[model samples]
Target: MIKQKRRYFSFLFVLPLLVVFLLAGCQLQDQFNAAMSRLAATQSVAGPTLEATKAATSEATVIATAAQTATAVANSTLVLWVPPQFDPNGETLTGKLFNQRLQQFEASFPEYTVEVRLKSENGRGGLLDSLSNASLAAPATLPSLVLLQYRDLESASLKGLIVPLDEDTLNVIGQNWLPYAGQLSEIQHNLFGVPFAGDALALVYRPAQTPYPPSTWQELSTQNLPILFPAADPDTLVVINIYQTAGGSLTDENGEPHLDTDPLLKTFSYFSNGAQSGAFPIWDTQLADFSSSWSLYQQQSSGYAIVWASQYLQGQLPGNELTSLPEINGQKITYAQGWLWAIPQGSSQSLEGARHLLDYLSEPEFVDQIDQLAGYLPVYQSGLDAQTNPDLKATLSELMNSAQPLPAGSTINSISPIMESSTLQIIKQQIDYIQAANAAANQFK
Candidate 1:
């Protein structure tokens, strides 16, 4: 394994000397980009394995083209675009923390100025849209770096809106981020982004009512406790999480998107049982998103609810406590997605400065602060250590460790409706779980 991993490195490297040496002339550009494939292989060396970049493109090449502007420009301004939740001027503690970090970046590298801009998370003038616009209309206006959702990163990379990261960054990320995080930072076999903040599904419950969160469906039924979750979410994320936890595989023998009927039956049967026990109310069908379900749980102080780690952590909602998802048997499971920092595909003049800022933001201290203050799961193992509280730290470690990257949109689209329909039917007592599971599986077959 070690021998195979060494193939990612073209040669041993030293940072300061390499940057200066590479910048000396255009003649060394080819040598500077000795191995573009290493840009993504860092994850493989770190562990669970990953694919190498298929194209012969690397940040060195990108930076090489604009090396003169980057070094000779004297004072350079690096622009960063973020969503409203990350607005530096906002009152949120996480926002304030970011503002402080940006200030620190400028102080550390006085030769560079970091400019902040706000963009919506989606839709008109959003990060993706604005990236597309700026890349076409005014290449110079493109922000040096942008924050993207894992799914959006896939889109941005596919459309050539974002560029691959350098090998050094991926090496650190592979060693720092949790396994799922490495997966999140990677898309289409390439390292295109660095995970800054991440989120995962977890259980939120009223501590006064239940001393310990139940770890199995049988316990919930035996205790006659109902857990509130959005059975109506179009994505069927809750069901998927539960299904996978019950030892089901989301892919078939063919390595394609699939539904395992036995596990589906087991999960749906829980819903059917819950409906009779009043663990799930008729109104659950009306809840289509986390907000509505979370609000309902708060109003009723209901037994349990499935919620995003961020929603429970960031909102600081009263009267509830967070824990890992209800484990099925001995295993706990959840799906995760997160924000990433990506360089927009444009002039590389700001690349050097942007990388500096990216490095600073990815520091363990900074990541720890965000995990505690911003309601995000720590992306790094060290960041997890920053939790401070032993109990919360232990719980988060287990849940985050259990997390897997949320599947692609196409996979979600294929399986969600079937899961949602079967789940709702069981909750509404419309059909036997066995029949429903069989019917759903037949569609995929």
Candidate 2:
């Protein structure tokens, strides 16, 4: 009976050892299967991994090295913040094109991957607002790069929300960039943004109704056809155009606004007289925004209107003629604005990687695609010449020559409301041109 008990105890000990051995074997098999699966998937996509094998390495060392390499590649990622207009999940044409470009960018740079976040273009809770919130609340979540309009660069830079581009980076882009594009990116002599897309003001007129298109504001004001323009829009581009055309300076020597000058009075008087003479339709009251003014032009309610190049491109206005704003003192001048690629101050991505991606996107080839798909003009001069569409090419060429980068410190947000109110008062005949211009100018002071 003692010998039987000893055998049974021995059996129990052996049984536990056997169970441990089985469990270990199963774990080894699982790890082996996972490694093999990963290898197979890599080979299928990348075609035979370029991993080098050491002549005298053990199997365990090889596995460890491969695992480390995979982890490293998995961690290389970039996050980009774009407007909702470029959201890949959306059905818009630009969205699809941007997604395709993003895929190509990833394929071209195998070591890095990109994730896109969509943000609203405008509003209290928009891209800029979100950036402000993120900067204050959780800066770690800020994007590696952001696409923003030219007007935002000054405010963003002043607030320390974006980093300035180094001279070397600027040199690389400056080689092929248009003069205005470079100018658009500069803030107090520092480059804080890289121009990607551009828009300029142009005159959109119906050729059937008006055989001759006016070349200057003076001529446009004297025309018999009911001229329409966004005189009341908050952008105040029309006001700027007129003010500049009449030899008015946008700012004084102290960088204060020079709105009450003789040139401004003359420009205002031209518009006020036009309103009283029935040359300009009383559409300012109805046109509180560009879209409303554009709608009026689109519905053929007016013979001519001033519009952005994008609007003209999108409208494909039939039987219409597009020309640079009428020549003032034999000089054609128009305001130009652009969207830029800016790196936020607290981005987690390596500067080298972010710059590489931006340079790739700014290539002439990529800019060409953007111009073709989106209505924005290319930042490169060569891209404009390469356009296949004759009409578009001619119009862009003329505008490009006359295009002036929006003046620094001339943010429309601050100046628009004042200009809009003054212009509206003048149009309503409630205030004389001198009085209105002085009032608008004083607000800036």
Candidate 3:
């Protein structure tokens, strides 16, 4: 009986040790399986990875994943807001081309969906006012991207809405964009926005009619023909351009308003004296419609007209016979500046995504399409150089190289209204005075 009890106690102690060993073995197996599963996953994507492949993939996967994430994040649906200048449905050349390009952007980057909204505001639809109001109620109501006219930069920028581009972004843009674009990006030594389009203005003339582009006010007056230029509110910018070309200063060295009497007198005297002598076509009083001038040029009713580059190229202006503004004492002067594409500060999307879209839009492939259909010169040098069509290429090259960019700093817009009103007043006075002077001369004769 005593021997049987000793054996039972010894068996009880051994059984507990055996159970502990079994539990430890199961735990080790579970840990091993988990590690093996991770290894298998890495091997599948990493191509049967050996020890050497592990280090390489650590770096490679990091880079690959980063690139994929960037593309994916930016490719998510993008929304763009355009002003009335672009009509997606109109038969206008700019309208047709912009739509096609929008399609192309979607096709090329399928990861991204682009939605373009055209908000047509009448003359009173102040972009700044509308955008400011929308942003307040629903901040997301503002589109991820906005198209701003070159003239509107101040009102837009001053509202603390535009984001400053960093060094990396500027580097990529510098590699791919035009000279003027990069230069304009820097505002007071800090870069703010990228230039998207140039609405350049030059003298549009019929080579057969004039035989020579007018170089001076004296030459233009001597032609004994009607000279035309845009002066209406839609194209009121022409007044500013003419003032600049005639040696009038829009802004002083320190960026102060400098639209003075001397410059106004010079500009008005040229037009008023010409009008009184019947040198200007009295019938062509309005410059609101480019077609009017185009009709005149095409019908040989006028020798020369000043027009926007886009109008001149797209047949909106009559004379296919075109040339740049003639030199004033051997110096070329033209008015040029247009809308720029930008993502406003505090927009819905991340800054990097906004920048990526900007980079894509400014790409050579996209810009060439815009240039081809719209007849606007490509702001990208690479795109312009890559232009294959002989006629289109030749025309754009001549304009881009010779064209002058308009100065569109903040001070310029603030004083434009004043300048416009003052200039017109001066012109009216000069015309009345010149008419009286001419009548007196006739009486004496």
Candidate 4:
């Protein structure tokens, strides 16, 4: 009975303690809710510090976005380096076309800017040497875009200085560019450039003097009239014109040098024979010194001359009918040559702006401009179709259809100087050697 009574009292004491604990827990919960409500009210009021923090975060985001946009805009400005072929006069077709179009491009694309700069080394200075120096110091005053010769593509590409353009960019330009331009873009399937300019061998003749250009070497040899080949030292240009007409290949598939010695020898033999026969003219020393290559044909003393198509077209003809050179075995061909525009290998602006420039140059309308100004045949069908002048259009159509591109590789570059030198020398040597051989033959016979 005593134990039961003590147990009951203990239970009563513990129940009071449990109730107190419950009350304390409830009170703590109420205090936490009240504190949360106070915080909500404070946030609703939006104190200056809180508002400032939010505004600062938003402003920072805007600043970050603006910085990113500015960086992109800066990147869109292309730094282009063009070869020094253009004189300051901007008189020639090449100069007029490039400079005028560049101005138009700038005005059209306000979002993009093109900075035309001069290349330290180009043409005469040597492309490979310039490219090497530029690669070592890329992205620092380096050209993001460059206008390079088509012939130098092999060397530049092999050195890892240039990047292959994306297929989209290539298709946009390549599908409609000139045929030779498209050919120059690839070297064993690797693309390196876009066609920008071209000049081909043409026969400028005066119909008033010779009525018709000879169809064979015999006619040229038989005619007593003086004929000029310009650049008395330009034997290589003449030789290549002859060699290509004869379907000669200077390089093989593996990039091996393959000059057909027999063709050169045969060509030299012809020159020797022709000079003795009084078929070759000795009056002119060089092609350009004679008031342009076409000046040879324009000369009243001359009947026909082989010259650059662009120069001839740009020249003022004096009622003289221009036609392709006389045919050999009905082949009826001439030496076709031109240049491509390429970005430097290590150019930083090569990504987007450079691509845009290339595309602009390669577009059909731009190609038409080049054709009209330079007298270069447009490689793209659309450009030719757009031509309005009947005579020019007809001539360009014939040239484009008949033109065959020069072989592109290091072999062409390697042997170009040799061909130039050898041809010039051979022409000079032929005169003396042929006369001596002729005299010696008579004595022996």
Candidate 5:
């Protein structure tokens, strides 16, 4: 019995150790299964995580590249060469309005910027003269665009300083422009510039003195009122006015001067008789430019005066009436000119950007605003239709429709001085009208 008890106690002790070993084995098996499950989950998720990370990195790279490209595009700029007459800092009304329009242009075109350089409109150090110098000195420094007078078109084109506008650009600009507007930019059947403003010769008189505006030269000659015009001015438009009214043309179909014609003779005769008869003011010889004649007229020195439409608009000639030139042979004729926008040769700006700015400037809305603000005749019919003053609109419409462009050619540069000298001689009684006409015409030959 004692031996049996000892064996039983030993067995119990061995049972506890075997139970502990079995528990440890179970724990090890459980740990192994959990580790296997974690490994399997990691393997399944790894491919998708890597792909998602790659997609995020690619998207970020694309976004960064797009931003860089946009920044580059936004940094582009356009440079414009304009006259101080349209100065933004000027005290004139047109100057103030021009600056406003410039601001609007800049705001509307956020992707591009504008830099303006002031240039002289006339004289030895004028815009074209400066451009010619720059072309010779440093062609690369030329402006992308230039504001030019209609008279400058012929010379600028001959010099190859400006580029002809493409057909696509012309088409986009549309065909609603005025007759003279298009004519100003048309050179050798090719379009070169865009017209911005229209100016014409018109008679300005105080309404109180002349309730009846003369429609014919006979009626005007009969009035006995002293007429004021820029007889001594270098611009030939005054001479052309009388010549054209008398059915004379300054240029032949080939753009050559036809100065000694019967029409010119008649025009000179009319002016000489009028001046000698005391119908035309003798003081006009002292008038150097339109401004001087305009000043004299403003002082009520004469009953009638020929002045530019631009001056009439600028002066706002209150209590004054505007009309076309006196009729000859029942036909009225006048000279019209324009300021044009043109791109210089070898512009650094991208064509797209330059075209965008040109398009913006030619918009009818902007043109209308310019008309209202500056008294410049609108280039578009829509602008004309928007005018609040019916009489002014009608007058401008009639003048715009009937007005002819000044003859454009190399000969044009010489035509003015010759005409001026002949007219001055006839008025001064130094030569008879026929002699003056013959002498002037011979110079063109």
Candidate 6:
């Protein structure tokens, strides 16, 4: 009886300890559950970061690599790189047409398989950047042909990334291409690209705002009305155009950028008159590029807007009418820029194919339809006549004849800053026309 009582007391003592251990275990489990819940909530709240983007890109690369399989390489493959605006597989009508054209080219030429890649129009990973990088590190992967702006064409030629066209290629190009178009690709008298799509400045105005648009700088300055342009553009296209309109030469015989005080004074005299007269308002000076001025004009829609023919046409906004630039000394003139087809230095074996493609693209029928749809001008004389609208045809023809190619990239790069500073000083009335002229000219010396 005594032993049984002792054993029962021992069981009661152990039962209390077991209950304490069970309570501690429950508390620890609850804490762990709370921590796990908090962790999930934090994860949900956090959005994708730069690190996530890089991780995703890496995963995609891994997947792509894993998917690759050994296969027989095609013979006579040609690779082409173009800006996004010219993407062949995009949803726009222009893209559809371009894609169809590529397919057509491939169908007609069975031996050649064309590969198209889209690149940004400017900046890092753009045409020039990729071209430069590939030229140094991945030469074998260099494109057979590339579409580049005239400025880039010059830079590419200077870098020796793009090769100059032979005499035979130049001769063929000269036969059909417009003079200014040919000039777009001419670097140091060597043809580095084949010009295809042309863009030029045009005057846009609302008929309701003004009965007749100003037809000359004389009229434009004296009218004392608002006119919008990128006066502060880093490119200093305004300065270049006005100086050229005053019969100034942008380059000397040696192909170096040159400036003369006479033309500079004449150009600034107009800015002086306009700024003082309010024809070119102080608010207009705030515009740093064509886009800002164009956007401002859209909201107000009361005055004249000077923009690229491409920008205006692509906009297709109602009530605004497009017209030729004003007459300067009985001549209709403006600055023109273009896109060109260029063969890379590594693409020697594909020269024949590249030239063939260039010739095919420059055909009047194709150029007419494509340029018209894409708000671009054809670089061929024949393409000019192909426009169905007689008035547009006439206007484009005049522009084609009178418009000059923008100054070479190197020339503009060297001269723009000096001229821009002086032009701003003149517009702001911080200096006289003579002072501005002298200031601009002295920089070149």
| Model 6 lDDT, residue 302, Cα | 74
Per-residue lDDT of 82-169 in model 6, one digit per residue for the tens? Answer: 9988888999888898889888888887667788998898899999999999999988878888999878888899999998888665
For model 3, residues 357-420, the per-residue Cα lDDT tens digits are 6767666666666765666656778767777867556756665565555556554456555544
Ranking of candidates on TM-score, top first: 2, 6, 5, 1, 4, 3
Residue 203: error of model 3 in Å? 1.9
User: Lowest lDDT 10-mer window, candidate 4?
Assistant: 436-445
Quote each prediction's TM-score. 0.78, 0.80, 0.67, 0.70, 0.79, 0.79
Q: What is the C-alpha RMSD of each candidate to the true structure, in Å?
A: 22.3, 12.8, 12.1, 10.5, 12.4, 19.4
Best by lDDT: 1
Candidate 2 lDDT by residue in tens digits, 174-246:
7577777888888888888888788888888776777778777777777667767777776778887778877
Worst 10 residues of 6 by lDDT: 66-75
Can you give the lDDT of residue 329 in candidate 3? 45
Give me the displacement of residue 434 in model 6, in angstroms.
2.7
| Candidate-wise lDDT, in order | 0.80, 0.75, 0.61, 0.61, 0.76, 0.79
Tell me the tens digit of each residue's lDDT in model 4 across 1-445: 5444544665565555556656788766665567556655654454555668899999999999999999988877877666555422357776777777777777877778777766544454445555677688544656666666655666677777777766765546567666655766676687777766666666666677677677665466457665567534333556555655555556657656665544555455556555556566555344533245455455455566666676776664766655665555566565555566666655666366677777766666766676666666566677778878787678766666566555555545555565554444444554343343233223312
Query: Against the true structure, whose TM-score is highest?
Result: 2
RMSD of 6: 19.4
Q: After superposition, how far is residue 175 of candidate 3 from its true place, in Å?
A: 3.2
Q: Give the TM-score of candidate 4.
A: 0.70
lDDT per residue (tens digit) for residues 1-445 in model 5: 4444544665575555555656788766665566556655665666677778899999999999999988777546777787776666788877787777778887987778877888889777677887777777877667767888877765787788889899675443545787777777787777788887778888887778788788877667556677888787867567777777888767767777767568878788777877767766578777778888788888874488888888888768668878777888978888777778888877666667778778777777776676667767777777888888898888888888778777665556668888888777777777888888887777766
In model 4, which runs have C-alpha deviations exceeding 4 angstroms?
A: 1-68, 83-111, 118-132, 176-178, 230-235, 247-262, 283-301, 408-445
What is the overall TM-score of model 1 with all chains considered together? 0.78
Pairs of colliding residues, candidate 6: none
